[model samples]
Target: MSNAIDRRDFLKLAGLGGVVFASGLPGFALAAGQDEFYFVQLSDCHWGFEGPPNPDAKGTLKKAITTVNALERQPDFIIFTGDLTHTTDDPAERRRRLSEFTQIASDLKVKTVRFMPGEHDSALDNSAAYREFFGATTYTFDHKGVHFIVVDNVSDAGASMGGEQLEWLAADLRQQKTDSPIVVFAHRPLFALYPQWDWATRDGARAIDLLLPYKNLTVFYGHIHQEHHHMTGHIAHHAAKSLIFPLPVAGSVPKRAPLAWDASEPYKGLGFRGVSVDTQSGQTALSEFTVVKKAQANATDKT
Candidate 1:
């Protein structure tokens, strides 16, 4: 008997593969042939932080903006991973911090900007004030055939996703196809990086399981204030660096506070990440670069 299968036979075989991909193969195939899209990932800006760890936090953020604006190729959008402001229990202070943060954001040349809440900005009353200014705790957006899911993994008082967000995540992943390229973003890492300092998400394993069925899945996060990568099977998790300050490596120190800088080179330790997502190749690349103060940058330009 002939072994060659016809289109009808292929469809019949696909039935056993599951319903998630049965209705999505055509769309996936169409998407696989399209061009890739790129985006910028900036994290832990801490716009209101005013301490020795970063004496020029505001200036560094502006330098980062300049760096992004000077990129050889502009990204399709910008995703600020979180910690938009410093901690403040007072509502007035929180609002003031947010206003200052927005004032800085207004200078951003990129039009489409996505924001998430970190524990610092979400603290005291469950991010009520943050939602009023930034809108929505967790949400999803589709860009160039890929699904981008931004979750609220950090709790109001701690690093956690809580039960409600987990349920929403399960439902959301259930709605996506198996072959779709899924990119998840949040403040705290979904995997346990270092629980001693509250660096990892408490119920992150459940979230990881929810994404297990997808073939091309990547999770981007910021909270540890450094760069790290964790892999669980096909899903890859990346922790982005902070624009304000860098943190000690997990277990490297007794505490997880931001690293103090040398006065001689204050901007040496501050940086942001640029992420390039290639859907056609199913590959993503992240590059980290520190912000140089305009004067320092200008000094280099003259040399």
Candidate 2:
């Protein structure tokens, strides 16, 4: 359970042979006063990745933590969408980078942090290393009557949910009450956003097909490194900006690349989002705020 709650209502969510967490999950009794809750969503930290798009890449994630901690209201938890670290084929380097990321993120004021892997973090060796650091790439959890499904689409040879995970998702949904609000978090866009950039998930259509039956569903993902709003039928999907760098809008150029850094306003296309749920009123509010503002980012770039 989150630190915001008085008592943890443990629930079982099936995936990776069906494990139980001390935190929220399906079948867990809703906590008292759970009608309203909020959490932060961060993505594409790329902790060990360095590139020209972000001259101050080293301090990217540290700045995010400081910014989140200073929010007007502390969130119940923080959910990192994916790409916790940059991709590296070297196994030892992968472990070292991920471990370092864990340490830096631990500095956050919020303790209930959920992690998934992006292709950069999980595409190597079928996500074996990612699982070693963060358990269960895909699973379901509940918070304030909301059913949240965290899916793994960046592993298994490419950005695809694959057959086994699809089956698990089906079984999980079958057990949930039909009217429950559903929110999905994945690293890749579930729909075919842009195949040329390797932005689309190969088998995402099948996943969306399964979710089409639900009355209330939404997906929050991180990969494109920009703010985007898309819809697959009634389900709303939104992508959050990356802490590292921003990629060009899909198909805007012949190939996908990080947008040329706006030197005049460094860190212009970078920020994090806060998502709040209001169960009694049946609504959610999302806000995007920059982690490293212009002045702060400018100073960071100098050092």
Candidate 3:
């Protein structure tokens, strides 16, 4: 299957109901509507990472939870895309950070919180600690009429879903009807956004190949720390903004580094995403809500 997004997919985003997604879609307009159900996506929290880029980092995740809770209509569940903790080589420190991160996320009003690993959580010990806190890294579940597939792409550090996981994904998809709406969640973009920075998954091509046969497939991923969308055949991919800090666009600079925070306003570009799926309307609406200075952040801020 070709990786290039078609010109037609951009036209569909206009009718998607207030989704802040960038694609090969040129001259797209925005619109809003009611949804059948909604959920929140929180990514790249980097709980234990300390740095000058963000002064109010300590309250980042907590602030995200508070904002989601204040939503007029609470989401049905929450999914943390990855980077539950900072990169820690210490075994005990890994467990400590994961524990703290889980505790904070556990405070959310919605109980069904699903987690996948980023390089930080899965690289060192092959995600053993993450699995202990969260179940099998790659699995599937059903919500409403949509089939949700969560894949583990970070355990290898090469951003490739190994052969074994790929096979499992194949078998999982075999059970669902070809026309069922499918949503895939992972830490890294399945396509090669930047091979040097590991933004693109090394073995992601095989996975995308497997998914090409499906008519209704969409991917929600993180690690890029910004809003992006693409189309491969009929499959659409959307990358979420981060909870910690924003990163530079793919290949915009020599290095793939997190963008420096605005000195005047902290947490300006950091926020979470809310995605609502309305089976009735056959539409999905995504909104990126920014957290401003850990106070007075509105969830309605589009992108």
Candidate 4:
């Protein structure tokens, strides 16, 4: 399948109680008869965020959790890419937000939920508080027939994955066959999407070079606060949308500020994503869900 997101798929939304699958991804061939498993990705929730960009910031995260719980088919697990909470200069407040975010996330019905840090959660203090709440910054695990790698670029504060982590990644990849299906979870874009806005990881190109040999590699990341798809050779990079609020496209304006709230289009560009992997055919389906439907948006507009 082509890497380009189909126009129809990009425009599709998860209406009140619906999920719309996007075009399938090619080259992930698993053995015949293997069952399909999917996971939900909720990124950039920014739990403590409160501002004009999202008037209902406090309620959005809970709504997303409710939506995921209400899915007809629950995911095997759920992963939050990054920015779990808004930045706070006070270390005490930071821990409080992290604790609160964890408490709320614990309500997720899935068996396993994984998390990584965004700059907002880590940069101020090298992820000390985040690590106190979450675990290792970089790690790897295997699910069924696929290998998953979680990279930490935000911890460095310089937006680089760092040499030690790079070595760890290289050693880890050495154990897997070049053709093994691999999925990487990260906070920032590995490639230079827009360096001016800090969208690109400083030393991410090196990590990308290390991952270049993998045949069925895909990356899911969040930081830009929008849904974006890109390619680095054979690897596909997908950026998830934010649950807190949406930001303008890369370089769309002179600044990287969050887009203002539109009373008429409440929750317009805010939601989570569902990624389904078909082991038999190696096809992956992406589904986008809005936090609120038309009626809900309208109702919230009145509030």
Candidate 5:
């Protein structure tokens, strides 16, 4: 198939609202009729979270799963970037939330699902519970023609990847050719968006230095609880929308608290996204979908 993707084709692939960002596949090449796949990215579900920011916290994740299942085309896989559950002092409560989140996510029709940890999920216990539920916090895997690396920035108390994981990342990057298409998943922004609100990784700059040598690299992350796009040299960093509640933009307000729930817009800033990767051209598009449909939002407004 040709690398070119038309708008209609992209919408059909996403089956939801999308604002496309077509980044050229610089340095990576694939022959005609090569691998082209799309995946769903849902982040910061914060299961067990209950408050004014989201009264329907318990139901939002399930709604997202149902929406994904209703998609016109099922994704090749699904990945949850981080913050699978809200933070709790009680270990038992944390595990309970993780278990519940996993059970609900299993309803997805997709075959493969990947996960990582956010500070809320890993910081308290250093990911002991998260590991028991998910696998290693940091690892690398290849899908089709793309190289994917999951980094653990939340497991460390300092919110840094730590020296050991940094060494591991460097060793892994050494194995790849410069032309390889690399995608990174992390819980926090790899670049400093705003440190005042803790939106940035403590030692993310070191990790970026390690990644700067590559010609084709992109980072998908969460924890900011909003859709954000940034560039560090040629590498692109995109943050997914949260499944629980949305937060104010970096330094937008005095604090980093979640945006207040909108009565008129029940699921306004809360939703998940679908990422489409065209291996032939090395282009990726993101489609954003709300947790509830227009009718649902309207009904909530009427009530």
Candidate 6:
């Protein structure tokens, strides 16, 4: 199968090569005989954040939890892509933010929640604090006939998944069946999204090479703080929006930063994404929805 995204768009978003990679719609739908599982993808909460990026970052996270709790059909599990806390080396600060994040989960309606590290969460000390609070740098699990791989793509300085993680990725995929539907979760996009601003993964090409043989694969990530999709062969790579704030589109500006919202509608641009996986048909479908915070009650009332 050819890559899903066009060469021009890839160059524009990735700011690297203008050469066409490949082209074809990779199958994400379930195969003929398998059970279906659905899940939610949330990213970049920055639990310790306290700024105009969005007033009351804590409240916005609470709103996210409430929204997930109220989903009409609950997901099989939840995956938080990364950046659970703001930039900080202080263990106390990290602990506090993690505690707050965990509190939000106390009322969660979903049974499982998986987490990965973002540059911000790991920048200070190889994610020492985050790992202490969470667990594991990278791991894999199988559910209902599908393979789920979570990778530690961020380095101590906020770089992409480096040599060590890539090696582990190759070994991990070697054990899975080629035909099995694979779902990879990470903090940064694996494909070249924009190397200029550190949006693209450093050694992502090697990671993609390992997955090229798989007939069915999908990658879900957060860190770009927006919703975007690119396809490479049979693999579809998606970046989820941040729970705290949104960023400008790739290359839209000289540099990327979270866009500030008007106080009246703080949660205006915040939302979560839903991914439905059907093992039976071997298909994965995505949809996004914004959550209304308590402070946005009037806005919701108006709508």
Model 6 C-alpha lDDT per residue in residues 1-303, reported as the tens digit of each score: 432323233334323321111212121222223255567888988888887777566577777787788766667788888988787767787778777777776778886888888887787778787788788979898878788999877854746677777788898888978887788898888888898988877778888998899877888899888888788975778888888888989999887877878666557667777765656334566657676635554443331
Candidate number with the higher TM-score (2 or 3) = 2
Best first by TM-score, ranked: 5, 4, 2, 3, 1, 6
Task: Give the Cα error of residue 183 in candidate 3, in Å.
Answer: 0.5
Off by over 4 Å in 1: 1-34, 293-303
What's the TM for model 3? 0.86
lDDT tens digits, residue span 184-284, model 4 = 99999999999999999999999999999987678999999988988888777889999988889988899889888888888888888888664332345
Comparing candidate 1 with candidate 4, which one achieves the higher TM-score? 4
lDDT-superior candidate, 3 or 4? 4
Task: Provide TM-scores for the models.
Answer: 0.84, 0.86, 0.86, 0.88, 0.88, 0.83
In candidate 6, stretches whose alpha carbon ends up further than 4 angstroms from where it belongs are: 1-34, 263-266, 293-303
Q: Is candidate 4 or candidate 6 better by TM-score?
A: 4
Model 3: lDDT to the true structure: 0.76
Error of 2 at 222 (Å): 0.4
Q: What clash count goes with each model?
A: 0, 1, 0, 1, 1, 15
What C-alpha lDDT do the candidate models reach, one value each?
Answer: 0.74, 0.78, 0.76, 0.81, 0.81, 0.73
Winner on TM-score between 3 and 5 is 5
Considering TM-score, which of the candidate structures 2 and 6 is the better prediction for this target? 2
What would the TM-score be for candidate 4 when compared with the true structure? Answer: 0.88
* Per-residue lDDT of model 2, residues 155-220, tens digit only: 877677889999999999998766667788998999999988888899999999998888667788
lDDT of 3 by residue, 145-169 (tens): 7888999889886667898999999
Query: Judged by lDDT against the true structure, how good is candidate 5?
Result: 0.81
Error of 3 at 222 (Å): 0.3
Off by over 4 Å in 2: 1-34, 280-282, 300-303
Candidate 4 local distance difference test against the native: 0.81
Query: Compared with the true structure, what per-residue lDDT tens digits does model 5 show for residues 1-303?
Result: 355455446545434322254333211112224366677889999989997888888788888887788876677789999999999999999999999989998998886999999999999999999999898999998888888999999998788999999999999999988778788899999899998888889999999999999876778999999989988887878898998889998877787788888877788898777777755334567667777676766564321
